[model samples]
Target: MFFATTALALLIERFIGYPDILVRTIGHPVQWIGAFIAWLDARLNPESEPGNRLAGMLALLALLVVTGGLALAVALALRKLPYGWVAEAIIATPFLAQKSLAGHVRAVADGLDRSLAEGRSAVSRIVGRDPEQLDRSGVARAALESLGENASDGIVAPAFWLALLGLPGIALYKAINTADSMIGHRSPRYLAFGWAAARLDDLVNLPCARLTGLLFALAAYFSSRTSAKAAFAAMRRDAHRHVSPNAGWPESALAGALGVKLGGPRAYGGRHVDLATMGDGKSELDANDIRDGLSLYGDALSLLAVIAVLLALAF
Candidate 1:
């Protein structure tokens, strides 16, 4: 039943996406989660208290109780009604990023085709680094790298939790992810404060990140000039070298599959981070490579959908 629910969620998010009208009216679930994170930060993590790691942990505990508790209550209430499982799928659609991720990546390509400045602006929305420092190849690489990492984080990870523990599971995952995004920085402000959110996000995303890498590798098997073997080799050689434990897997897989190199020095608000390079391919990338990456990601998504169906059948 959970697998079937995930399949329906994939179909819905892949096609309809969340309607703009709905977003304008009630706002998105993530926005609501972000709001809660902000409120907690303002109250508990004040500027005067930079080393409040225990406070941060307690705040995260409060967040878990709120999000997980509310989601469980909703799931229990929905379970008693007819056709409620379909409602669960419909509700889960907003959590997945099938259409939005593709759209953002495509926008970067389109922007590059138009002008370099336009390309930088489009990529800036999706990437955290300084887009102004990017050249043509840099812009394209940034887009593709974001596509790789987010493919697992935004799509596969949530779906994995949804299929495993239903509504509460996904809600809890999203809440933790939101906290990590908000405060899990090495900056003095959050270095000690957001330790739990950052660490837990890494732990939860570990399995799904590797799963997404394998899916991308399998998808590459069907793509011309792309090798699953190369993807696997890249993952093994480069994943651990990355600064992040989870993001490296999918990024290396996609970079290897597409025969392109990603990850180098990137600047965030004038802070330079020298990241380990992933994939042993061409250092330069173009808009065409971004399109190829998109195609490969599409095939991987299809494979995930097929697996969901298989799970529904087998169970």
Candidate 2:
């Protein structure tokens, strides 16, 4: 039953995605979670507090209680309805984001064909870095990197949790993730207060990130444009190079698969961030590379669906 629910949600999200009208009408679940986090931050995360870390821990506990409880209530209520699994699947659909992620990444490639300024504008929407500082290669690399990282965060991780513990599982994961995105930074304001959110997000993402990397390697094995061996090897060799314990896995895999160097120095908010490079390949990235990355991403999703089906059949 869990497997069927996961597979159905994945397929539905892949084809139709979350509707824009629905998003505009009620906003996303993540946004709702973010609102709660914001409220907590304002009340509990003041910089002057001596016990900032303790406060952060308490805030995280509160968030978990609320999100997990709400999800459980929803799941239980849906079970009472006709075709309850279908209702559950519908509730789970917005959590996974395969089509939306691919579409946004593809838009960057499309924008690049028009002009460099347009390309920067498009990539800026998805990435956190300053777009004005990015050159043509930088913009393409940023888009591809976002694709790899979000493939884990937005798609694989959610599906993984949903398969394991149903609707409540995915809801819990997203709440942790949203907290990490909002407050889990190394900046002075967040360094202490956001510790629990950042660490917990990393812990949950660990397995899913590796799974996503392996799926990408499998996708490369079936593709003529990439080398599967190199992709896997690169992931093993360089996945730890990033500051993030999890993001490097998929990013390194995609870099080696596409024969492109990623993860060099980039700017975020007027500050230059010098990071380790992933692949020992060409650094000249362009629109075509972005298209190829998207294709590889699609192949990875297909492999994920097959795995979900197999798991369903087996368990």
TM-score of each: 0.98, 0.97
Where is model 1 poorest over a 10-residue stretch in terms of lDDT? 44-53
Winner by TM-score: 1
| Candidate lDDT (C-alpha), each | 0.92, 0.93
Q: Write the per-residue lDDT of candidate 1 for residues 1-315, one digit (tens) a residue.
A: 488888888888998899999999999999999998888888888887664789899889989999999989988888888988889889888989999999999999999999999999999999989999899999999999999999998999999999999888889999998899999998899988899999999999999999999999999988786888889999999988889999999999999899889999889998888999999999988889899999999999999999998997887
**lDDT winner:** 2
- Weakest ten-residue segment in model 2 by summed lDDT: 45-54
Candidate 2 TM-score versus the reference = 0.97
lDDT of 2 at 294: 95
